[model samples]
Target: MHELAIMESALDLALGQARQGGAGRVRVIRLRIGTLSGVVPEALQFAFEALAPGTLAEGAQLAIEQVPACFWCAACAREFTSADLIAQCPDCRELSGDLRTGRELELTSLEID
Candidate 1:
């Protein structure tokens, strides 16, 4: 799965940062994964488990923060979060195409030793 490649990249980045900081190992790897990012959380976790062994992040905790999809409803003049591809404003019941968030697949931070 593509999540394997994604986890490999993330692990590389985390290891690089840990080395740069003079750390011997990585304690934690925090990621912000949006609902609409097209990446499955379970797949990613499986990838991490497969790829982490014998590396600096061998025992690193993978902390994923799931971000809900948010859209701006011009009709309602407010932002709302949902888990649907076709977002509809709750108040106005209007379809909103103004996406605000929930398309992210970012490695936010790392806890290293």
Candidate 2:
């Protein structure tokens, strides 16, 4: 699964940050995941379990903040959320505009000792 690779890279980044902060161990990792990020939470969690055992984040808990896919409709002059990949503006039915948020895979923070 690509989640394995994603989590591996994220864990490596966390480990680097932890080490930079002089952390002996990591307790938690806070992630901001968006609907459009194409990541499955269960799979990512499973990947974390498999990859964390031999690192500073061995016993860390992964805290995920799920963000909805949101978009701004210029035609309608409004913002909306959609579970669909192709979102039509509710009012104007336009399929174009600046995507306000979502599409995120950000590692927000890490709790360490």
Give each model's clash number.
0, 0
The runs of at least 3 residues in candidate 1 whose Cα sits more than 4 Å from the true structure, single-residue gaps closed, are none
TM, every model: 0.96, 0.92
Worst 10 residues of 1 by lDDT: 81-90
The regions of model 2 sitting more than 4 angstroms off are none
List of clashing residue pairs for candidate 2: none
- Per-residue lDDT tens digits for candidate 2, residues 15-96, read 9999999999999999989988999989999999999998999989999889998988877778899887778988888895
lDDT string for model 1 (31-71, tens) is 99999999899999999999999998997899999999999
lDDT of 2: 0.91
